[model samples]
Target: MKKLRNNTALLMMTLPGLLLLIAFHYLPIGGILIAFKDFSYSGGTFLKNFENSPWVGLKNFEFFINTPDAYIITRNTILYNLVFIVLGTAVAVALAIALKELRNQRSAKVYQTFILLPYFLSWIAVSYLFFGFLSADKGLINNLIMEPLGFHPIEWYSVKAYWPYILIFANLWKYAGYNCIVYLATITGIDPDYYEAASLDGATKWQQIRHITIPSISTVITLLVLLGIGRMFFADFGLFYQVPLNSGAVFEVTNVIDTYVFRALMNSGDIGMSAAASTFQAFVGFILVLLSNFIVRKIDKEKAIF
Candidate 1:
């Protein structure tokens, strides 16, 4: 009776949020079936009137597989995400360790706040800020620095070659501090007695970090990596789209599945096809998550997300 009362109370408190989630997230899942059907606005909400709309099961998937750009977009998505996962984690881990060494807690928190500020800024805003530095015509980079050094002011937008480095740098700047805070939290949770013992053994700071900090946080790092790997098929839409500003020349390096889907939806206005693309992304992400967690379980069962 006590457990049932507690459960009922919990349900009462959670009902509103549950309804909101259903309205926003789970309720929309029905649209995923549109990918398999010839969904039409004229056909009403459930997409009736198939005789007019028509069904093309597996055709969209086939279309994507046969397209030459499939390999390219797939490659770009995987490569960019892989790099972000590896480098982002490493850099964040390092910063977290370094910050933990600071004696003044308030000063450390202030520095953390400053570092995390950029993450709250929109990517579109970042794009314009970057324009001031890289814009070919009147950029400060050209007038003040590159020109002073007698180098030509390269047209950054028109050039596809530079986007790889540009994307990596942008990602690092925006996410490194945010990610570091997670590792920092894990680091702070460690028992101080371990560190005290290491110090008593005359361990240097670097040695202590290498021997203690990294090893202690390895489980958290592994869990994070597994979570990241699950979303390997996904890409940040703004980071890929707004950052490049739809430059046709740079599409080779910047185009990913999400951007391609956006372009198709905007141009074709084909709800079914767009749904198919989105469903594809969700499916890939789902499978990757399971696969990654399985691998984690194999290596270290305790660290697996499941």
Candidate 2:
């Protein structure tokens, strides 16, 4: 009787969070069924009547696979994310190491706050800021750097060749600081006695970091890498869409799964096809996460997400 009462009381305390999860996350998941339907507005409301919306199981998937844009968007999405995962983590780790060396708390905090500020900015806002620097005519790069050096002002938006570098650099610049803070927290949580003992053993700075610091943080690093791998099949909508300013000229390089789906749905109103793309993405992401978890467990049992 006491256990039953405690369970009910615990349920009551958690009811609000459970309700929020159902309201926001699980309830909307049913909308995923639209991927397999030839949706139309004939139904006054989509949820009220899924019966009138005929199901065409595999057609949408077929169409998206056959799409010419499929190769480009998928490649771009995967490649960009891979670069972000590697370069972003590298930058973060480096920054975390540097921050760990700082004994002064105030200076460290100031630098950290400044670095993390960029992560809070919206993609659209960052896009405009980047435009101010890269704009062909009056951009800071052209007006202040290239033109001053008697070079041509390259049309950044119209140019596809430069976007990969731009995107990777932008991703690092915006998110590295935030990610480094996580790494720094992990680093700080390590026992100072490890470093002190290393010093007693005549360990140099590099040796201390190499043997003690890197190995200590390996678990967190592995966890973050696993999470990155899980999301490998997805793309950031704003990074691909807003950062390049949605210039059609740059679509060859910048087009990604999210933007491609948005275009297909909004422009062509192919709800079925767009839903298929989304479903495909979600399915792949799910499988990848499991596969990733398995791989992580094999490499380091302690680091696995499971």
Candidate 3:
């Protein structure tokens, strides 16, 4: 009781954010019932309609799980996320380390700003930017480079074989800069005395970095990787949809669970199926976080997120 009174101001400071969390996250959880319902708007209010809807238990799940495209969508979602997690971590850490080595502060800030600029761009804008380089007749790649080099212009959008690489590259380009900023902040917080001590002991730059820098940031890296594991079943909808201009030819490589659900929702207007898909995603994501945390705890309890 005494401690609670003493920390009253700090607890009060957290009240607004707590309320927002309840409003946005906790309150809406009741809508998960829609997953099992043949949901429709009949009259009164959303909650009332939700309540009155007839239950069709698990029928909605069949729309996604029993479809022929199920395997493809699931495979693409998992594979793309695995690649993103591995490559994104490597590139972000490498760039952060390289940026830290820059001697000139002004140039470093300028470079950081330029690198992070793409992160702020909407996927629609990035799609147009990509179109400038990929347009068959007038694109810079085709007209300037391919023609000058005596190669034929490729139909970039129609080629499913190339989209896997293209999407991976685009994902990295948009996100790596922002990801590196986190690592760079972690690196900056590291003590300079460790490096000085290593240098006095005749350690090279590489040795000092390997021994000090990476170890110091390992916790942040583990935390980020665990978070990424939780979202392994979700893809960035815009990256798969808008970036490819929604090309049907590249759907084999680009279509993911989110995109598949969106297209299904658009065509059929099946609210129950869409809700079911979302519920499934949330359940799988929750399980994944728990499993990953369990493994991490077994390997190194200190690094486990829980």
Candidate 4:
């Protein structure tokens, strides 16, 4: 009875968060049914919208799957995310190790602050910044480098070939510092005794990091990679949309699932199709997470998220 009474206060403290989760997350789950129905906003009560909508079953999914651009969007989404996961993890881990090795605490903090600043900037702001550099007329690259080297200014916005590299670089610049903080924390928690023992055995700094530091953080790296895989189907809408300035010329390389859905919604005003696309993304993400966790469990039961 005493323990139950003591736990009652903690339960009461959690009630608000529980209510919020139900209201925001679980409540919208039923709306997923809208994907199956041909949803339309009728001029009537809110419930009437669903009631009057026609049931199209799997037609919406079939339509999306059969679309000509479906393969392109899916390929772009998966490939870009794969590149992001691999490059992001490598760069973040390297940055974390470098920061860990920095002997001057003040300089380390300054470097961290500068690197992390880009993560906080809005994508719209970054787009304009890119404009200053990539603009064909009076741009930094054209005026400072190209013109000086007797080369004509390239039309950056119209060129499809350059966007993939630009987008990857922008993603890394914005997110690497944020990701590094996680690895840095893990690195900081590592036992000092391992390094000391390695040093006593005449191991160099590179050898110690290879054997002790990286091994210690391998589980964290695995967990993070799995999480990245889970969301591989989703793309950052702003990064793909705003950064490219919605230029039609670059759509070949810049288009992804999210932007494709947005364009479809804008053109067709079909809420059902939009909902179906979202549901598809969610379902795929859920399956990937489960599959990744299963594989992780087989490899290392202790490190499996489940």
Local distance difference test, each candidate: 0.87, 0.89, 0.94, 0.94
Question: Looking at candidate 1, what is the lDDT of residue 182?
Answer: 91
* Better candidate by TM-score, 1 or 4: 4
Q: Is candidate 2 or candidate 3 better by lDDT?
A: 3
Clashing pairs in 4: none
User: Model 2 Cα displacement at 276 (Å)?
Assistant: 1.3
Error of 3 at 109 (Å): 0.7
Number of colliding residue pairs in each model: 0, 0, 0, 0
Question: Which candidate do you rate higher for TM-score, 2 or 3?
Answer: 3
Writing each residue's lDDT as its tens digit, candidate 1 over 43-62 gives 45443454466678977777
Compose the digit string of candidate 2's lDDT tens values, residues 1-306. Answer: 888786997879899999999999788788788888898766587666677888898999999989988899889888888899898888999999998898898998999999999999999999999999998888999999998899988999998999999988889989999999889999999999999999999999999989999999999998898788778868889888998989999999999989998988899888888878888987897898899899888987998989
Pairs clashing in candidate 1?
Answer: none
Residue 4 error for model 2, in Å?
A: 11
**TM-score for each of the candidates:** 0.91, 0.92, 0.94, 0.94
Candidate 4 RMSD to the real structure: 2.1
User: Which pairs clash in the backbone of model 3?
Assistant: none
Ranking, lDDT, top scorer first: 3, 4, 2, 1
RMSD of each: 2.4, 2.5, 1.8, 2.1
* Greater-lDDT candidate between 1 and 2: 2
